[model samples]
Target: MKPSLQLKLSQHLTLTPQLQQSIRLLQLSTLELNQEIERFLLENPMLERDEPDGGEYASGPTPAAGSAQDGVNGSEQPSEQDNRDAAHEEQQGIDWSDTGSAPGASSTRDRDNDEEVDFQEFQPAETSLREHLDQQIALSQMCDRDRALARLVVEALDDDGYLHQTLEELLALVPAEHGVELEELEIALRQVQSLEPAGIAARSPQECLGLQLRAMPEDPVRKLALTIVEGHLELLAERNFARIKRLTGCDDDALRAAHALICSLDPHPGARHGSDDTRYVLPDVVVRKTRGRWTVGLNAEAMPRLRINQLYASILQQHRGQGGELPAQLQEARWLIKNVQQRFDTILRVAQAIVDQQRQFFDHGAVAMRPLTLREIADQLELHESTVSRVTTQKYMATPRGVFEFKYFFGSHVATDTGGAASSTAIRALIRQLVEAEDGKKPLSDAKIADLLGQQGIVVARRTIAKYRETMSIPPVSQRKTI
Candidate 1:
């Protein structure tokens, strides 16, 4: 084969730098988008945020570079040298000495200082599970070698408080010179398990339950619970009350008490003392009702208020064609401002369309949520399906009832007896209601729930009911029944 040069006359879609930035910004969540904006502000000096108190950036036509002169109001506009002098003053510290005493300025500073102090005092410190366990170990009265071994065991425990490694495995981790043995590790393990959380270092679910049961007073019920945890844990999980009774010789009332007590114990004790990081969700759009009409608007707090730095931009325009990186930076700044505006516009439009389609949901909650899909919204808004999916990925809307992700409104349809379709969300909500209002003495089974839904014009299967019930963390009828 010989190498030859050939020209193909075919056109293909290509993503420019600006287009790629727009796509990346569109898919980011509110928090991520704000971080991206901050990065752009740092990298590009020509881009700066508008005043927080000022309204959002105007989505109308972007003014020409020559129109920057309109920003100066006085008859004698400031010259280039005056602008440079002002920029220099801003770069340096503000000269409060030259400004003398200004009215209302001291009051503003006092108010800001007071707010800063309050925020600093209320801020929380993050602490992890290992740190908490180490603190408790420090206060314990243990010898040096035992304390070191206990620290090793504490480090081996996972986030769920379960010790996945065996005693031999942990012993191998210690240096031989320390003369650590399996028996010493076992003692250290018990010492670490004796922390505030009753079952912090158990090896299995049964052992975890046993540890908690042992912590309680020796009563008939507690003894029965301990026996059940020691042996017959599988039968207990299967809700095989008859078999458990045969093995433990407990009556219905005693078995019920033991089962309740077991359920009350924490399965993952270490989770209670885990990381204390809090994530706050900020809705991208705010939906409200006005004069009996539903309306959707952008959340000002969540949206990034960005604008082209008029001073820098005007200066660059005056010195145009003096080849350097200034022209590229200015162009990049314009692209960012336009892209941010476009990203929010797309979000607002998609949110409005969702609210319009799922108006019943806003009016009557999840039960009234109809069957919707990305294709339907895309077709209605004349956008690509991928674009719609990107818009709904992490965007959230604050409705009258509560906040919900944009994708929550889209679900598969379930055929109904009335020749119409019902949303899977609505079906799940109905199942939850049926289970909540069920009789404890005779809990409704999956088949009965399916039949009830069938009578209500929704045809769902028993297995589907079971799946949704499990998804909602509702137990089986056997587990839900009472004496």
Candidate 2:
């Protein structure tokens, strides 16, 4: 075996660096792709940012967000909001578009060419839950000892304003030298609970609602609400009005009123004071109707305008093969530029294909969505299923309905009696419709929902319906029922 020296011809697939970059760029989300471009710009001296210009891709100076219908029409003219969003995205150092023009792009130059300059305005700081509570405690008319004890209690409370630690546990956190007692801590807890946001500083949700109920005026509904919150909260959550009546001896009208009152209380008071960081999604393509037909356009903001450095290019051209790595860098930069363009081109093609298949979804919402598969799209586009999968992974489409990931358009199918198939998305949408339109006194169960779908020629099992419902965060019939 060791002496064998016979040569055999073989062929295997190989991935070039350029091909690898193209594949990677295709799979990355718009944000990730932009980040990769920035890295390349830093690493490759030949690569540079291409300043957006009119007659090409017009980068508007405004930096404000726009609605789905911002640039839908045949007009390239951007609204004021669109211009602002485009400019803001550029300033944020995030390339959000791949289209030649940004989503909210406007003209690059000013008509007057006035020497007007832009100013950066400072946004006020957002206070955290602890900071908010501390401010309130500071302003309160409490003794230093009480204030310190209350501050300790506030520290023990979680972001949801619930005190998860028991009095003993909290007491242990206190130093033995502080001389803090259980009663003192209880008094401090009451002080914090009595602060603004009625349900704050409660040990449990029941106590939170009960505190709010206790603060309300002494009406029969308030009393009943408090009683229910403190004792029959589980029954109330289950929506078992019958059992509630059996236990509390209340009539339908009274229980309904009390239930309404209970619903008004906030379960998480501290959540209002919690830091709210809204993450805005930048769609890779914009879907809109033009002349009664749906069309997909790449987002220009998501596109990082890249170009080779002319100075370096000229020098390299004059001294070919002399700069050693410079020649390779230039070639690599060109590959990246071509690859980026190809990446977006591939993305646009896949997204358009998806829109074509899910046209019913765009026209009549999710309920009208038909069955779709990566195989169907791949076959139509003459691409591998894995390529289609990569294209749709982190890519997003901006439809008039809302911003949705490319993956949302793909789902399992349920067989129909007429030999047709319905998308799982559509089935879930149907379930939601059925549940929403159900009578409050008797909500639809999974079995009933399944039967309802069966009548519609869509064969979905009760368990499957339940699973879809759970995924949608919809409650069971027992929890959905009302008086």
Q: Give the residue spans of candidate 1 off by over 4 A.
A: 1-10, 58-111, 118-124, 174-181, 218-220, 245-253
Give a tens-digit lDDT track for model 1, residues 1-483. Answer: 999999989989999999999999999998998888889899988777766654556433334554533343326768998799778767886776676633456888888878778675677765677888898899999988888988999899999889999999888887888787789899999998888688889999889989999988999999998998899888888778888988777899999999889989999988977775788889999999999989999988887767666667677778878737877887898888789889999999999999999999989988998999999999999999999999999899998889899999999999998899999999999988998999887899999999999999999999999998998899999988764
Per-structure clash totals for the candidates:
0, 17
Cα lDDT of model 2 by residue, 1-483, tens digit = 577678799999999999999999889988888889889988999887766652233222211223222222325767998789868887988764555554434345342333354332346678777788889999999999999989998898888999998888988988999898899988999999888778888988888999988888899999888889889999888777889999999999999999988888889988988878877789999999999889999988788877666667667778886988998998898898888888888999999999998888899999998888899999999999999999999889899999999999999888999999899999999999999999988889899999999999999999999999999999998888888
For every candidate in turn, the CA RMSD to the true structure comes to: 6.4, 11.1
lDDT to native, each model = 0.86, 0.85
Report the alpha-carbon TM-score of model 1 versus the true structure.
0.83
